[model samples]
Target chain A: MNLYANDMLGEPIGLLLSLLIGAAFGFWLERAGFGSSRKLTAIFYLRDFAVLKVMFSAMVTAALGLQLLAVTGRIDLAALYVPESIVWPQLVGGLLFGVGFVAGGWCPGTAAVGLASGKLDALVFLIGAGAGSLAFAPLQPRLADFLHAGACSVGSLPGQLGISGPVGALALAAIALAAFVGATAVERIMAKRIAR
Target chain B: MQRPYWNPYVAGIGLGLTLLLSYVVLGTGLGASGGITRIAATAAHAVAPAAIEENAYLGGYFAEGRPLAYYLVTMLAGVLLGGFGSAFAAKRVAIGVERGPSAPASLRLLFALVGGGLAGLGARFALGCTSGQALSGGAMLQTGSFVFTGACFAAAFAFAPLVRKEWR
Candidate 1:
């Protein structure tokens, strides 16, 4: 019954839901070839558009779904937990993460799937990730300002862009559709180049 | 022979539904790095419990000295298990290093480590990785998620050329 388990622990139902949800998350990831590092990093090479296709579709789907639920009064949008929009850290972290993603060949979620599929490199990557996470402890103090800068916990694209939620969702969907088309074209071009 | 992977769009819908279900049930979305961080903290606690207890970034996870009890931790376990089941059924279970034709296994592993390290650091800085930030927060239309996603892809593309031999 306790939906907000972020600050609490030992909630049996919450933990159970976490397991089931994670199972589905991992299952779909593996199904989408995300368990393969090469497949994941293929986006960088413009060789495979699976990552883009999957990510964009997923984002649009969830965005619309959440909007529908909120609009229908089935769920309260404000109750959902979303991280604050801290621009500085996100920008810096995202840039670093991008490098890591391409070089490492897997993100943390996919890396777990990769490890499960018996990839030795995934195990090593996980060790490194753990070490890196631990490494952040010492630097947290110095990075506090940058980390918390522009912290807007409830900020959304719709609110910032001066549009309604549905409008924003439609715009994102449109963008994703265009991107998907572009992704397919890039894939074809890359495939042709590799073929020759 | 291993079966072919699912279509990206189909699998993506499945993933999205799972995320929606997560939000509906848990009032939150999926995550991976947070779990990894806690697991790392747990290991550190085992080695130097007192040190971890006082760690500025990690100390909060030790409130009950049971970092593994969190939702993300359980979710991580499920991710591993579910991935194994799917891969196993598809006959894709193989123990090996994934790298390009010219890259040595050792070199590939080194990249994996370094890359993973950077990703972990970045995830900590941003408070999430692809799962939490890009997918979860992206669906929520959080502005920073888009920024992070944009930055991540841009940086990856920028770095891809330098690491060309690794995946070519």
Candidate 2:
């Protein structure tokens, strides 16, 4: 399951709430300097770390929040759905996706915002995405086996790693925190070099 | 003047809350590209209704009637509108191409097209985009999502220098 209201047929929300949430999502992304291709790509060049910081911070925030809620028994953790494990396809697909992201300067969602915010490049990108999706149909059978390869069970993190949920969550947080700190140090050092 | 952004940490909390709110309200996480897929599938059906019915993947969304009535499509519409609204309030809205200083506008546009094509292609094989898979699924501690995120970052890092001229 997901975090929005839906009818039995499976819609996410009422139209109005959907728009409001989407706008907020877009607004925050822009405020974080995501609307700019340069800013987004800057992380790759080690010129800016906002993308990593924002993403990691968001991940930790949500993960920790969910973990806390699960512990408190406020929210039914089991009811909340997560994506299933599909290893090989995702690993290969992710590599391809990431390379595309650096080249294009925006992911699917951000590109939507980028286009709306008047980035012509983003518009072109979206069009390409459309074509690409359509193009995948013919090659489907060949990639089909790979796509479904490595089918591990769902919520397989702690179970697969042989740890409790809280422990796994904490470990994730610690790792993210370390990365955050390291990123900050690297940013400072890079800025100093640039200044010099 | 445009209002400044909320701090990254603060924004992260806000986004996280939105995500959490989504789970509480709808019992799932946030997603972006699935909406596109639904819409795209619906649109594709327009041209080939019979073929769509035959195709296992695209046919699933269209089995009912119009694919436009679905939630993901609505969410995506909201994503566009929301993004537009945010850009509007920030005065970040402008009509033009974005490119690196060293790159020509047309060249940048071309790269954007190719890059986007690859991403769209990759997202499907992965079963979702960064929104549906990585951000939403990652927080939920989904194995595939993490794997996907890892590959994406790894690939991006590996290819960043190769495509440096496109953005450098």
Candidate 3:
């Protein structure tokens, strides 16, 4: 399959398709109630689990779909762009991003949704985020070495585990199912406590 | 009043399909932070074209031509339009600051700004945010994505209490 790999669609047309893809992304986010800061932050309060549920589901679905396509030879998995797994910076970055998530009530993507939904705070958050990125520019050189620490030789989880892609995807799906059940239980328990 | 939101699982499937479409058509996953960073770089470039272009981090964005011409920026514009359409259809499009009852609007906005800054900085460190790293790369079962996901949630849960008043 040509699969539009390596910019086969070209820049102008590719960008048009990108716009449609982003529209779909934002559409689902809003439908999932991510446009609301309270709804997003509710996970931190143990008041809701939409974030986890939605995220895990989406991840599992894509993983499984990719595996299936690869197995069927419908697409070449190697053609996809997979970011490297660098441990230290990603771990530290995740920690900081998490705090920001609960505090700001949005990530980069959902913040755009929030802003579109007319949340004034989302606008301020975006500006601050932009400034934050710019702030990191000058420091990039100093942190370059530390940021690249623990770069995994094998990038994908399947490769790291020495398992086939389908197996790895299945494992992830199972984990997601278990987490969904646990998330529901937690939400139920939280609801009961609030009721009292 | 706005209608209720879609079920998480259902919406997630929709999102996943969209991601799959992106991968198939573009051979790349979705992203948001890259666009945000590029926009910042472009704005800074206008004021200090030499300085911005010379900076190690921001300079790379200008290497391929105008930074604003990147696909991520166009996708971001699409996100805004799509979000607006969805919210409008659901009657959820209203101008306001979202916050807890006890929190003042200014305080809420302040927190938003600070929190956004932190998230943005963190995204750059991790090389992506929730969309780019946790979701897009995550779907590909990248080890760093899982690490980032675990650490992000753990840190958020640990720190949520400190800002309890913001959302509680």
Best by DockQ: 1
For residues A71-189, could you state the per-residue lDDT of candidate 3 as single tens digits?
99898888887678998999999998999888888899999999999999999999989988998898889988998998999988889889988999899999999999999999999
- What is every candidate's alpha-carbon RMSD to the true fold? 1.3, 2.2, 1.3
Query: Given candidate 1, what's the lDDT at residue A82?
Result: 87
Docking class of 1: high
Could you tell me which 10 consecutive residues in candidate 2 chain A have the lowest summed lDDT? A3-12
TM-score of chain A, model number 2? 0.89
For each candidate, report what fraction of the true interface contacts it reproduces: 0.86, 0.69, 0.83
lDDT of 1 by residue, A1-196 (tens): 2286354434877788798889989999999999899889888888898999999999999999999998998888888888888888999999999999999999999999999999999999999999989999999998788889877755798998889998898899999999999999988988798899
* Residue lDDT tens for model 2, A1-196: 4343224325434554555666666666776767778888888878878787788777777788888888998787777656777898888779878988988888888888888788989888877776667667767877778777898865558778888777877888898889888888998998999999
Query: Looking at candidate 3, what TM-score does chain B attain?
Result: 0.97
Question: What Cα-based lDDT does every candidate model obtain?
Answer: 0.91, 0.77, 0.90
Rank the models by DockQ, top first. 1, 3, 2
TM-score of chain B of each: 0.98, 0.91, 0.97
Candidate 3 structure quality by residue, lDDT tens digits, B1-168 = 999999999999999989888887788888999989999889888899999989987888888776877788988989999999999999999999999988889889999999999999999989899998999899999999999999999999999999889888
Clashes of 2: 11
Interface RMSD list for the candidates: 1.0, 2.0, 1.3
DockQ, in order, for the candidates? 0.86, 0.65, 0.80
